[model samples]
Target: MAFACQRDSYAREFSTVVASCSPAEVKTDVNGKKGILKGFHVVLKDTLLFPEGGGQPDDRGFLNDIPVLQVTRQGPDAVHFVQMPLNLDSEVHVTLDWGRRFDHMQQHSGQHLITAIADLMFGFKTTSWELGRQRSTIELDTPEVIPEQVEAIEQTVNEKIRQHIPVIVRVVSVDDPEVEKVRSRGLPDDHAGPVRIIDIEGIDANMCCGTHVSNLSHLQVIKILGTEKGKKNKTNLLFLAGNRVLKYVERSYTVEKALTSLLKNGPDEHVEAVEKMQKSVKLLQKTNLNLLRDLAVLTAQNFKSRADRGPLFSLHRKDGDNEFMNIVTSEIGTEETLIFLTVGDEKTSGLFLLAGPSELVEKLGPRVAELLEGKGAGKRGRFQGKANRMSRRPEVEVLLREALAGWQPTEE
Candidate 1:
């Protein structure tokens, strides 16, 4: 199907003939959320909605006021996917999401300018580009993009944007000699009909099938955020265009102000203050751990002196860490001593530990797990495991007390 974007991408609204409308199965998002994406693929006689292609996202809008969620090109057709079905012959009014469409225009057009500059200035061709919701990226052919070169490119591109360069889209023959002027690797194997060439006045021309702004000034600004090492040692240049740059600037200031208040330091000194605070926290954590170990030993001694607990002693401590509880049991146990300990409270589930006679360990291990919604094993007269149901701690305690009732300790 022929599209208006192939000629004039700035057309916000246009009505066209409906060639075909049918249900479709679409789940092309690479790392998308799980769910069946139900939509109707409507083939139009002509369209202004740019179908997702050539590293650009699809245009989102409405058809007869019904939401057109996705658009894609399959073979020769530009498929408009809507939530609800539309009549085959009805002339539907297509409305482009103006804000989203313009944003895409800024980024896609900005990318073309950047790609041209990078190739012309540094001989680094863009391998690919991603038009993200928050930020866009261009993957370059080279492993390294120096900071100085990035700055140079920024200076040059922003100058072009300020110049308000004219972007002209012209459809040409596939074998036309002017096609050689396009700074493209080549056309696609499945590509047919006239080739669309996007020419930035006095800057460069490239073959692409994505929507772009008519004037470079509409981009407002292009900010090269940073760069990272990408697949096969390529340099991925992170960037923001137009409203996204403004969005980033606003978020950065908000975060900076919040951090300044929280850390009790000016934005300039935040890094230094954070590093100093981290060092102090490490020292305090060491002291705190030593104190906890000492408290565990003292708690064990206090439990042993309690005449009310009898021989078969049991304890329940909320939010008790299992490893530290083991250390406590080591201090409290004797050959005849049987201690069943469960940790955590009703708000959350936690672990249980049982240390006792081998016979008792084997008998009660499975029972403790069953009561607390957990599982474990008994070894060397000790049984320990984690429980999933924290509120059932009391039930485990009741079951243990009933089992040990009328029991007499045998001679070791």
Candidate 2:
């Protein structure tokens, strides 16, 4: 999140003072009660400690042994909170956790680099940004960015990182006539203080209050993870930078090496190995289909041989896949024998009941479904239902026959 400092009549003087206080510490109250002496004071980036405004988390660190519970913006100055109270004139050394601060800087600086490169290379202007814990995202003005364009932009960002460009922070009065000429996305108009601007030398400049690295080279690398389409022509870019990028690379390499060993190939041959595996899977699927067709034929013949004089009924009991049940319902079901098949997996089960005499089956289908604690309807004589629990095959068959016997043809 970025904030525009309200420039007052003494804006120039404030800029000079704040610039000098690049890292300043002041006495503050702790525990939000009486003003007792606390351990030490802390310096915070003006934008870093905003408890309000944008929904960004506050910066937290320790001041000597005392913990800085929260960093928040109080008007123009950022207030740092501690567990213990502070005295009126207590003196303590203030230090900003350089590691945490540098991480934020690298992320912010990398965002500028990528956004700027995207604008220059692809004409995709960044509309807004969200800084998150693991990944930060920049929303672009356009909805669709081609994959190739993203790859190119990523390359450019890293190329710039390698160039080691200077990331300079400047504080200029909002009233400075030159300020209007500069293009910035989010600049607060009613600000009474000098605006802090981040300048990536030879690349981009924008009004931003977020802390940034002194140089782009410190970023090391910028990794574009992925992009998502947003409402009204916007693309959200997820990216990582600096140590985060290194961590991602290390983890990814580990996974790749494991996959290579499993596939018995080098990193370059992994793609080919996966493709071959996919082809093998397809062949196995074809063989399975053939076996299912053969089984359906044998089952149909067996049902025909056991045909009863009244109503030839055949119940094929099998706990198998849905596709096989569908094939059985389509192929074995006929006018002579009504087929009732039950399929079950580890978690749930399903039933497919098909019969001839379209009218009888249609009328009894819903009742049969109800008996099995399921619900289904169908045209012609075929019906299917998904059961919430495993149902006894005999009970279902009996209820189905009873329903069929009770069913009466109705005038359409």
Best candidate, TM-score: 1
Question: Compared with the true structure, what per-residue lDDT tens digits does model 2 show for residues 1-412?
Answer: 2332221111111111111112233454667764444333333333222332232345454444456665656456566666554443344334444455566667877888888899888898888888788889999999798889889999988888888898877788778876775558556554557777678998887776666677888898888998999778799989998998887888889999899889998999999999999999999988987887777667666665664534535454454555666666666555545666666642346655555568767766776677667777677777777665444556767776776576555657
lDDT of 1 at 27: 71
- How far off is model 2, as Cα RMSD? 9.9
Tens digits of lDDT, candidate 1, 381-400 = 78888788867777777776
Full-model lDDT, candidate 1: 0.84
lDDT of 2 at 174: 70
Q: Which whole-number lDDT from 0 to 100 does residue 18 have in model 1?
A: 84
Instruction: Count clashing pairs, candidate 1.
Output: 0
